[model samples]
Target chain A: MSLDQNDIAKLARLARIRIEPESVADLQQRLGDILNMVDTMQAVDTTGVDPMANPYDAFQRLRADEVTETDQREKFQAIAPSTEDGLYLVPKVID
Target chain B: MPSYTVAEILQKLESRECSSEEITQSYLDAIAKQDGTINSYITVTAEQALAQARAADELRAKGDAPALCGLPIAHKDIFCTDGIRTSCASKMLDNFIAPYNATVVEKLAAAGVVTLGKTNLDEFAMGSSNETSFYGPVRNPWDINCVPGGSSGGSAAAVAAGLAPIATGTDTGGSIRQPAALCGLTGLKPSYGRVSRYGMIAFASSLDQGGPIARTAEDAAIMMQAMAGFDLRDSTSMDVPVPDYRAALNNDIKGKKIGVPKEYFSAGLHPDIAAAVQTALAEYQKLGAELVEISLPHTELAVPCYYVIAPAEASTNLSRYDGVRYGYRCEDPQDLDDLYTRTREEGFGEEVKRRIMVGTYALSAGFYDAYYRKAQQIRRLIRNDFVEAFKQVDFIAGPTAPNPAFALGEKANDPVTMYLEDIYTISVNLAGLPAISLPAGFSNGKPVSLQLIGRDFDEAGLLAAAHQYQQISDWHRQIAPHAV
Candidate 1:
């Protein structure tokens, strides 16, 4: 149930959140404590229990394919950090 | 006007004893005068609120305004408000202006309620204490040094401090109820799917439910009347008909069976809180409700299960906050990875980042079954315990929180201790039931609350019982000295 420095680094990479090298040990300790708390669930006998994902156990509702939203590109894009020609601007991915 | 309950305020408006503009102005004045030390509001839309209040007055003068017309309320910043900042008390969305109104805001507006402004909350609604807020911790109105439990802390504090008559709050793992308890107000977390979550920012999808925080259950019921219902925009919103919450407020609870779970009164519960809960139960007994001892044996695992499920969901839900679209973006990025990592790293707070990392690890390859799946399976068992208990009892009653509000920064460094602050209230969320936290009494000068959990979609019954309690008890009437 304990997380090491390496595990913390791996989790940070997977979650796409950078952790400063100095904070890694602190994160490892805290995350390890949280995991220890979560480890209590291991004592329970959930062998035959179905994992309850939703409170109501309801399935995702489906509607017929139809255009429901109006194009608000201009309105929506106005709030973006960087945009050009009605598209969000980000670093170039191409070689 | 600041001292009046929502019901009293509505009555005054109905009788023309006051104008909506006058009421709204008084509250705004109070906020300006009192909120500096309390720190409840994140954004106060004074100009917009007055304009809306004047329009409400104009409509009322014409004689066809909605029931709650002209009443002012605060929204927890987690709910999006078009043209207003919806920070969720995090730097991530601090600059993000919601392009459209949340369904809750829309519904309340349609009911003629004026928006006082957006209130503060724990960052991304992730923590038990409001201290996690990037803006700063919300000070408890009862004791300025203490926290008003969170992530709905600001809303609770606003109402308790008489800055607003009522406020909207979301309870994922006791956000609304815990703060209500600590701040001496009534807060309800309607059953899962009872309230639409359309534009209310998500923390844990399955458990997040928006409800009202008011000084009394009658006020909460009035607010809930406008809040609860079906919405097509939210797929999880129930298709059930919205009941007349106000009409059901006075229904007799004389023969109601209130289940008192032994697990709730464990050694960890403070003596003052336990005594207050017992005193409240005695009052319920005086009103002829029977207290039946019940057991929710899996109660011990609720916090553990919730920590896993909530963080797991948060990790996925927060993935949308990349640097591209809206919200906080990093200074410079060499590549796409840098853009994503640096944006999130700089945007989120410590607790939020911790949760994301924990969630990522839980949902990661090879560990999914051991952590996420196991937590979900235990979640089922925990829910089953409630289901069985409810079969024998009409409702469940206990302390809203283990103790009263702790001083700010006391538990900030220790996440687990803060997580345990919600131990008593999280199980209700796990079971997806409606529950209300009403001011029971004061514990060591801090407010204590008694929580009542009801069957799914039984908000009317829960509110009625809480309303009945408020009728005879004057605990809810005790105002914070700072507020006074």
Candidate 2:
């Protein structure tokens, strides 16, 4: 269950968070300790147990397919970091 | 006047004894004078608050005052306040002003509660101590050198220091109650789905619930009456009819059976905290309530189980914060991947990043079954333990936290030790039950709280018990001297 620096780097990459080279060792140690603590879960037998996601055990209520919200694109985009003609701008994707 | 509870303030406002403008002004002034040392608020909308107060006065003149009319309160930064910066105390959203109000904010505003401003929290409500806040740690009002228990630290500290009469707080894993305990205030986390979560920035969606942190159980009840209800906007919002929480405060708890979890008083818990909690239990016995010893056999696994589930959900929820949209963005990115990674790395604090990493690793292709699925199974066991215990007793009681407020930097470097702060509180969230932390007594001069957990949607019972205890004790009334 121990995580090495390479595994830490893989996780950061998977998580989409950049890690500095110097901090990788520190992250490796902390993440490893946390994993070690959680490793105790393996000892518990969960045979025939259902995976409980919601605490209430209630089913997700569905709504009518009809549009319920008014157009608030302008209002929402007002807080965007960069936008053009109602489009959120990001780095170029297509070569 | 600054020391009045929400119930008292409401009466005064309705009788025209104190104008909303005057009350709001008093709170604004207190926050301005004392908040520098406490650092409880991330933003103070005094101009907006005063304007709202003036309107509330006008409404009062027309004899149409709402229950919360003119009562100024702080919202945890996680809940979006329209046109106001909702930082969640994270640099990632340091500059993000919310375009729409969270359902809780909208509900409170509709009830005529004035927004004092947004309060600080553990960055994205991640840490047990407020130390994880990107804005820096919030100091405990009781002992300035000690840490205020958090993710809802700012909200608790604000109310405890009289910055605001009451504040809205969310509890994923004891965020509200832990801070309330350490700061000597009352914090209640309603049953899951009891409060709408719409626009409240998601940390761990399933476990995160919005509630109130105030000076007393009655005040918490008053605020809860306004905050809880079904909302169409939030899919998980319960459709159950909202009860009159204020009326339920006086409901007699005589002959009620209270369960004392045997595992809660383990070796790790502080001796003083155990004694205070035991004394509080004895006081309940004096109130004609019977104490029943019960065992939640899976209690110790709550922390480990929660870490896996919360972080897994958090990892997915936070993925939406990629740099391109609203939020902190890295400059001069070579590509889209670099933009996201660098932005997050630069944007998130150490604890947040650590959680994201752990979550990502746990949910990876090969480890999903072992980590994520297994944790979910363990979650069921933890919840079942509560269900079984409740069959024999009406409520479960334990110390809100293992110890009183710890000194700043005491467990800052050790993540496991920090996670242990929520050991007793996490199970309630895991079970999606209602729980409250009341000011039982003090340990080492800092406040210790007694936590009570009830069945699903049973906040009424929890509040009533807390209210009865509060009537017989004055601990909830003791304000920090330095705050005054």
Q: lDDT per model, in order?
A: 0.93, 0.92
TM-score of 1: 0.99
TM-score of chain A of 2: 0.94
lDDT of 2 by residue, B1-484 (tens): 6678888888888878989889999998998898899999999999999999999999878888777888888999999988999999999999999988999999999899999999999999999889999888898989999888999999999888888899999999999999999999999999999999999999999999999999999999999989999998888998888888888889999999999999999999999999999999999999999999999999989999999999999999999989777999998988889999999999999999999888888899999999999999999999999989989999999999998999999999999999999999998999999999999988878999999999889999999999999999999999776564
Number of the top candidate by lDDT?
Answer: 1
Model 1 regions more than 4 Å off: none
TM-score (second chain) of model 1: 0.99
RMSD of 1: 0.8
- Candidate 2 regions with alpha-carbon error over 4 angstroms: none
lDDT tens per residue, model 1, B1-484 = 7879999999999999999999999999999999999999999999999999999999999998997899999999999999998899989988889999999999999999999999989999988778888889899988999999998999999998999999999999999999999999999999999899999999989999999999999999999999999999998999988889999998999999999999999999999999999999999999999999999999999999998999999999999999899999999899999999999999999999999888888899998999999999988898889889988999999999998989889999999999999999998999899999999999888899999999989999999999999989999999898894
Pairs of residues at least 3 apart in sequence or in different chains that clash in candidate 1? none
Instruction: Provide the TM-score for each candidate, comma-separated.
Output: 0.99, 0.99
